[model samples]
Target: MNRVLAFDLAPKKDYIEYINRGREERIGTMKVSDDYVRQCEKAKEIQGLWNPDVGDWIYSYGSRSIEKVFGEVTMRYTKVWLPVQEDLQAILRYETPLVMLQAFNDWLYTDSGYGCVNGARFHSMQELWLAFVMWERFSKVWDGKDWKVV
Candidate 1:
């Protein structure tokens, strides 16, 4: 089944790397875009088909507000969404559960013990810089209390 998802904007280098890795591993090329997302919303909006739930979904989809407000290059992020094929899905399904088991370890493993809540640990200044570059694009961050999207 197809599903809509939001993903953070990473660098061209990382994107290329991901593509390369996928190809080498027979994962196929990745497709990430928001054209379909925008098209769906536009179609619904034009038909006056929006409700609170639909409105919320559109607003939150792809971190649209965060990407627009934060501006790329500052944090260097843009939202991307794409389908996960069966081959890729299989790998993700197998790994997702096991990944959760190390949640505690991940939290304590970061070099600085800070960053995204999913608990990604940066091991180098370049990694930190890349994260800032990626995140600098998000308009707001969850300041532990509330979301400030401007």
Candidate 2:
């Protein structure tokens, strides 16, 4: 995974955990922008990365699509968004920035299985660090057509 911004530290609450928490709590408060939604789209494991639509098959991760994930979130949740700019300064503020970053990167890789922390729980900080490689190699504009091309 490619490193974008390198910070010595992170914030008290990582956005990933916040997202999972909202999911677990059914709070419907975890809202993300179209950009983040796209990022989440890239995070999913699509069936075919290159092939176009076919019979009884398409790019979908079970029920993990962006629409289903953010379906319950409304305008109230949208208002609370902090707006993570191109540099990703907003996410780096978390307590363990590297771990968070890596996890996001690994998640985006369709072949990656559960990233570093495989299971549903984080037994140690090491696991967080392991799963922190999911967001690397990501492009700002991923409309399933044009990605962040150099």
lDDT of 2 by residue, 1-150 (tens): 322222222442212212221122211233333334434334432211222211111113332222222223333322222221322333344557686556566554444434434434333232232223232433222334323322
Clashing pairs in 1: 70-139, 75-133, 75-136, 75-137, 76-133, 76-134
RMSD of each: 17.8, 18.0
Q: 1-150, model 1: which lDDT tens digit per residue?
A: 322234455533222212121111212232322322332233321213222221121223333331212222222223222222322123223346466335424533454324544334443332333223223333332233332344
What TM-score should be assigned to candidate 1?
0.17
Top of the candidates by lDDT: 2
After superposition, which runs of candidate 2 have C-alpha atoms over 4 Å from their true positions?
1-27, 46-150
Candidate 2: residue 101 Cα off by (Å): 12
Per-residue lDDT, model 1, residue 1, is: 33
